[model samples]
Target: MAEKKEQPDASKDEPEQIVDPWRVVTTSEKGVDYDKLIRQFGSERIDDAMLKRFEEVTGHKPHRFLRRGIFFSHRELKNILDLYEAKKPFFLYTGRGPSSSSMHVGHLIPFIFTKWLQDVFDVPLVVQMTDDEKFLWRELETPDVARNLAYENAKDIISCGFHRDKTFIFSNIDYISSCAAFYKNMLKVEKLVTFNQVRGIFGFNESDAIGKISFPAIQATPSFSNSFPEIFGEAADVPCLIPCAIDQDPYFRMTRDVAPKLNYLKPALIHSTFFPALQGAQTKMSASDKTSSIFLTDTQEEIKNKINRYAYSGGGSTEAEHREKGGDCDVDISYQYLTFFLEDDDRLAKIKEEYSSGRMMTGELKRELVVVLQSLIGDIQEKRRAVTDDIRRHFMTPRKLNHKA
Candidate 1:
């Protein structure tokens, strides 16, 4: 008989994971391999040594997100820490693109962590509302509609408890006109970067609009301190530490590349993992899809219903089978959400142990998550209701922030 030939395993040929500013997709039930992403994106992993150094430098325990590895990657973070140790000046920069009138709970991750950072470091913070980016990307009615969404979203952001004196939040449409220095830096970045450069960096093609091609420069301008001369006082060398999700890295990657050419300091970044959709870890939550996320505006009843009906369960199909095999917390959406919101470490650990051992049924695990989300969203709704037009204006205004930098 002839020698038998072995066929290759077809499962190994699964589609590549996709992660960018617009989308996140993965085939694995366990979610995107962040270690692969760190290697692909050329950013350093946040290890325990760095965390220890961070605590030593700041004299404060790291945020839950940091300790739990939710905020897992970084670029040039050590430089920012060194600046802080030397009593030198540095600020924070992070932003949001308003695609809808209301933000989902997933949208709160960066802001909640950034608020903690601002409190600990006592530094100035700048938040950009990218209304123009949304207008160009989404099928919105008009630029005015996008601008209105920005204002609505800003109210939610302000409710996160950022200090008005230390934080400056501005919409691109309004701020570009009011601030001359911001526009100047945008122009500087645009002049240096060619069509091919952005096309390669952002996956832009010939069919895309010129506005889309040029918008990266607007996002990049904030990395430089001189762009906010009123706040940083013409010192282009003053650095900034940006706390944002990993998907936002492409813009800052281009910003860092252009910094040396412009003689500006490169901004440091701390990247958080994506907030997975309710369905599963296969993708991120989308503002346009109501079923994919639990929005800030969702009622307590709605939250409970969503958790029961839609949140993906990693339990066995039958109660007897689940009890025999135990549940898998790795792919369970309810357990994943608790990791992000539930601050009590011991409680979370106990829940994990019980759920994984099949001692706690899926219903019980989800009920715990539902309670956490209900309380969190309820508190946010109350705070947002208190943010009047005047309060929003104060945060949006272009004024000197209260920071040594």
Candidate 2:
């Protein structure tokens, strides 16, 4: 079960997905669709052969989805990985501008990817819950929306298997007040960035708040270790590497620009493509639209129903036509989702073959994606149930850094 495809910019009214590809893609007639990616992203696109070279450069296989074009864009990812190989530890930072209650399954992408990086590198992690940001852009009340959503967001993020000893979660409301170093970093950034700079990078308006205008600095603070001096032992020199969805790159670009003046190491980053809505890749899925995404709280029946009713399919209208023409896995919703969640390379390969050649009907393919995602979310929900406000408070509090040196 999958939803029918809609116009590319369907989520135009949605907050985050309003802008089209921040960049572009390139397409060649002979091999690979470079044009679609450049058209979607911008003039810059990461092609398959380029990805193979990146893997060879790093000596790690590109994550399958990266290989599959689900994550078709990047900026300075190789540099970040190279730094890691040189034994330079870069802490991880990523954020959520909590705009809703219960997060949808798609929201977990960065957290899950980041958790892997943390374990692989064994470094400290700081997750920014940008509730203040939600208030700045949307009509939501600042205190009520931020405090409430921070609590709810902590639950969803904790469900992603982060280590309690190593992970720190902070809402802008809570952390900004407690950390002097954070504010200092914020001021340094504010000093370097002008209203003109933000306007050019983020398309911000002059009517926006000194708070909203200054908000990027709050997002930038965690990239410095001293933002949590208590946690990083007041180590201002240590740098962080952020792994985020590419839409978020503008903030860190500003951060990196000011790092030299601040005498801090510029943060390295690994950015991802936007996770397409259940409707399609042209727009991001919105929590406001029930049919646009699958929530973590969705029951098995709800999941099955959502997939059947809303997940977009590339399968042809008629079964005979589908068999004759074969499925286009390029925008195939089932295959697309599987690329994110399916870790088993062999089974994924089989599914791709069956799907693209039309050996498997869209319903059957959707069922596979449903099963894979249901298991993932079911496991996450069990962990989420164990998190309490007390645990959240402990994690949120600034504590002494457990420094090995």
Candidate 3:
């Protein structure tokens, strides 16, 4: 879920951008400067050559997210591709910190892309729901609240169409107790990572709880193949690829740094940009804020009302003025959302052209997005409704995933 951090003055030419696990904040209408972020994070850009290489190796077109540079930055992705090319085994790891009962549309980006990746690569995937992290961070009534939220969020993730045989979703609170290999890896990470190191990586201070200080190890454990003996057997050397939002890079950065010392393969990563809120690109959508985004549970009328009422418009004040001056798709929330959801490339391009040229009004552009989202969310709702407790349990169960490793 999105939270904004208080920052220095926005009047400056460059507002101080703050992106971390808990918050994503920027004052720019065009959102965070991802190129600057790529440099700051020391991650490589997913350039044209890389895309070409990916297509060549996988024999599948790069996902729309990759093609559009939505998942824009990466670390050691080529290593994973090379492993795939050589017919060696690798898996996927991604996670959610379950803070809310229902996840907003922004929460689906990684899972959607991960599903595509799973289909393309034919590999196993593990989704970690960090209920323990949420319990430490959030002011929930009890640990059970966070635990329940994890289960709820898993249904939404499962609704993204991950194959049951290829996907295993687990809650941190639940799995750490049951899996000895996972706990061993967590202990290994905790031992290698000092208090000073964690402070440097995660900005943990002496005032923070011991739980908060040590939680990075829990998140890092899934990156190692030996953590799940049922899935990968005793082969602790099998590397894994993590598909996650760039905000999560810090946890994995620490994991990667410690991998060699543990004699384990470093996890590879593919990073996605934050999905901007309906209110504007200046901040990400908050699951706690009903008006900030479209929730998976929102009705058709709510979707329409939210977009029409709250979606930040880049058009002129009046219809006549809009027609003359044109809308700015670059800053338009509706147009930005379409870039994520609308699948038809030609149609999206056409919409972009017409809207930016003043030929299309803000309402018209939003109407197009509303239809696309309603249908998309409608389909997801249908799928989510069919995801029973039993189905979710199967996805969460510790079993051998159906993949050649």
Candidate 4:
């Protein structure tokens, strides 16, 4: 019999047991069935027919390839599409609570999809970096850490090709200082929203600070374009829409409930499902947990090493077993991640077929993912490198935005 051929260890730096995918499987788990998750996430699946219908209905080719299931879940998206078709103006609002120096790959999903939406609709995009929220949560030195982190996060976002003329990026700490109009709107939101409502909406205990109760208002302020009157001017007549994950719905839900009473446009919403961490969907990724995600700053060599070492696989023991039995690609972390990055529709379909039917080995699947992701992240890192302090300051400066409107 031929000697059992051992593959070269892609994991050259680590110890033997650390690279095991089964390490994540402490007890045997019948992993997350994604089809069931689609229903649970409250977004309709976009099949090929739906994609064709979406284009016919909108009269524009989608800015994104909906084929890969990136924008998987949506609520009230078609209604908003109708509004866009009518040439009605609606601003895009989405935010991130800056808690760390660098965000993980999980962090980029919304921004990537949001960039596509901006290109598709040609609408204004307002990105809020919630430094205040981070200050309240972490034991940071007052607001400095949050501010610094927000600046870092903003650079990563600016790398996403957002049009500076149409996009306004704000850090709560910095923007709050000069934009008294923004705060005036925030105060209105604060008064209308009750402590009980916040407790119910955010799961805030009574022990939380007055600041904690107030932060939601800061988030809500952007939903109204007039908060930045310099940008929106008296055109408070223009309604707004927010595109963020469903976990954030409560803030907007509270806003929607209060907008009518306040006589503001009850901000329209488009909610997406939570981006699953590399480990799984049950919990969001933590920057504190280094192993839970692949970050943009990771090196090409590091990307390959990490996937080989940490990315979960669904292939069998022997190549013979893989060819005969086929691999289970449904829950494999590597294949699922590839769906997000790989752009070629036909190549992805073929890969899916081969992997699902066990024709392609897990190593092969991971190898393909590694190359594509390496290029994507490498390109991002290059753009990020070119973003100098001068460029960032221009983007971060509140006054630079065309507030004359």
CA RMSD of each candidate after superposition: 6.2, 7.0, 3.7, 10.7
**What is the per-residue lDDT of model 3 for residues 275-316, given as tens digits with 9 covering 90 to 100?**
998889988888779999999999999999999999999999
- Weakest lDDT window of 10 consecutive positions for candidate 2: 23-32
| lDDT for each residue of candidate 1 in 314-343, tens digit (9 for 90 to 100) | 888999988988889999999999999999
Report the C-alpha displacement of residue 352, candidate 2, in angstroms: 1.8
Q: Residue 288 lDDT in model 2?
A: 81
Residue 146 C-alpha lDDT in model 1: 94
Ranking by lDDT: 1, 3, 2, 4
List, residue by residue over 91-154, the lDDT tens digit for candidate 2.
Answer: 7788787878789877888888788767666777888988888877778855777668887988
Q: What is the alpha-carbon lDDT for the whole of candidate 3?
A: 0.91
All candidates' TM-scores?
Answer: 0.96, 0.85, 0.96, 0.85
lDDT by residue (118-195, candidate 4, tens digit) is: 877777788999999889877889798789999998999988888877788889999888888888888898888888
- Model 1 misses residue 62 by how many Å? 1.1
Poorly placed runs, candidate 2 (over 4 Å): 1-83, 401-404
Model 1 pairs in collision: none
Q: How displaced is residue 274 in candidate 3, in Å?
A: 0.6
Instruction: Give the clashing pairs for model 3.
Output: none
